[model samples]
Target: MGASSPPRVTGRLRRTSLVDQAIAALQAEIDSGAWAVGEKIPTEPQLVERFGIGRNALREAIRALVHSGLLETRQGDGTYLRATSEFAGALRRRTSCSELLELVEVRRAIEVEAARLAAKRRSDRQAAELERLLAESAAAWRAGDVGRLVGADVALHTEIVRASGNAMLLELYESFGGAIAEAIRTELLDTATYSRPTHSALVAAIVAGDPQAAAAATAAALDEVRIGRERRSIGQPSR
Candidate 1:
């Protein structure tokens, strides 16, 4: 928490052509879960119609997403979503594997402090958003949809970091989000998905302004994820 209030946008973003607008629109729909990873977007004609933009703008948008690794076009098969975010796409393109544990460690270091700051400074609106994201994560857990769970879980953590009001922290956490989601899917997909109370408890602590509790909760949640990854590495049972 700082003495100054949270930063505000002083002015609207500069207006752009239909191509930029289409790009933003497409990313918004994708981020909103309109299409899960690996799903094909509507056909080009359908997208062109949906966005009410010319073919050129839509194609430019598609190409940008493809370059960003958010979408992939297969010859004769149509363009399919490959990753949910640019960070995730970058992760997939890596020729060398980054250790998942290393990623989790960085996340733990960032999120623990973030949680404390969030508890101190989160607005009621931010708390409500955390509640909504928590419910989404819980629902994904209930459905046993690991993919959805990963998205919702990452979103929850990212929201907490955002609420901390630290732009740098938020950027670091976002960069790690893809690997964190991957770690969850790899390590906790089978076990501990519901083994402990996590998002709910963290939300409670933050909303209550209990910074200590918030920090404890975040560290515990990340530790649980790390332990799961360790258990798999050692060929131990999830329990």
Candidate 2:
């Protein structure tokens, strides 16, 4: 009999589970402005030692930040931080209702396209999820719960965008997540009516997969919200 071949040895993949540590180290550097936009990151070996992790784990952490658009990598050059907006500066600048209206107008443009795409491309699973969220929104409105209503509203619109099956559009929407949520809370929740037929109409249009009707219903709902804000402003005593 031929000599039995030596049992093949399979070495387990060695990896660091210290993902959080690596993320924290890099986040601290970014927060401290040590890594400015366009600045190339340190080499993989350097990062491994700096973050005290195996090369594989460090690479994974970098990959996560890259997906979030905070970092970018070049095939041969190096990874670099992407330019980020200074949200603090934006907050410091006062914004008027007119500006808010313009923001809503932009949202309308984006959402109209999203709704159209969703109507044409959404899978059965996505449609069902949209219906579920709309039902939740209706229940919240009937209960006069602004918080729940706003949450449901955000989820419903997010689902619509997701159903559009456009990665770039979805990414753009996610980038504005915080600002959009705040806008809904300050603008819509403050003025939304519990008995508004427009609310139901919008949900119905989305459920029925009627993109044009969805767009119209959304516009109408926003119009009423703008009117409510105006009325509130007029009713307030002069400061």
Candidate 3:
């Protein structure tokens, strides 16, 4: 049969096997939670070392994950873990409109109490951390870096939740992080609204050890989001 076709020599099968193995290895990294969503993944060389595979195979694996919505490549900004999986990606996409408003409400409920408890029980170290994040958020706001602004706000609020000394509450807030990020970004896109999280007030309250003030400040921050969303939905100009 045509000289046995030279034993059907082809690197195709080997390449396919290597790509598949790299894909599997990358999945394990996502599932392990060491690589978080929205965080940039390691460099190509680092990934090659991590997967013990060729660079080409790793690129194919990353491309596949990107096509699957699990990764995102930001043109010279490096690749980021966009989602834990396809299902999570779809879930995040669906968090909009009324569902997102409901989530904001949920955040208000959790964060109000968290700020209250944090004010009553926070350590000096935690308070300082909150102050640091507040300054970072302010700087980001001034610099017009929406991503950093949202990140700092998220970290600042998470610190408040952490100071509450309630592990369960902190976990819940962390789990909602992706959706919350979307909400913050959307609101921030409307520069006219400018309704940002009340960082200075909230941090001041927490630092001052005033439960009522801390809770009030948190509520005010979230209320800005809600009010802006409502005005936009009604096609009204920002006040």
TM-score, prediction 2? 0.56
lDDT score of residue 229 within candidate 3: 66
Q: Which stretches of candidate 2 lie over 4 Å from their true place?
A: 1-95, 192-196, 227-239
lDDT of 1: 0.80
lDDT by residue for model 1 (70-103), tens: 8889999899877778987876454222477667
In order of TM-score, best first, we have 3, 1, 2
Of candidates 3 and 2, the better by TM-score? 3
Error of 1 at 144 (Å): 2.8
Report the backbone clash tally of model 1: 0
Residue 83 lDDT (model 2): 33
Q: Give the best candidate by TM-score.
A: 3
All candidates in order of lDDT, best leading: 3, 1, 2
**TM-score for all predictions?**
0.66, 0.56, 0.75
Please say which candidate is ahead in lDDT: 1 or 2. 1
Model 1 misplaced stretches (Cα beyond 4 Å): 1-70, 73-88, 93-98
Which residue pairs show collisions in model 1? none
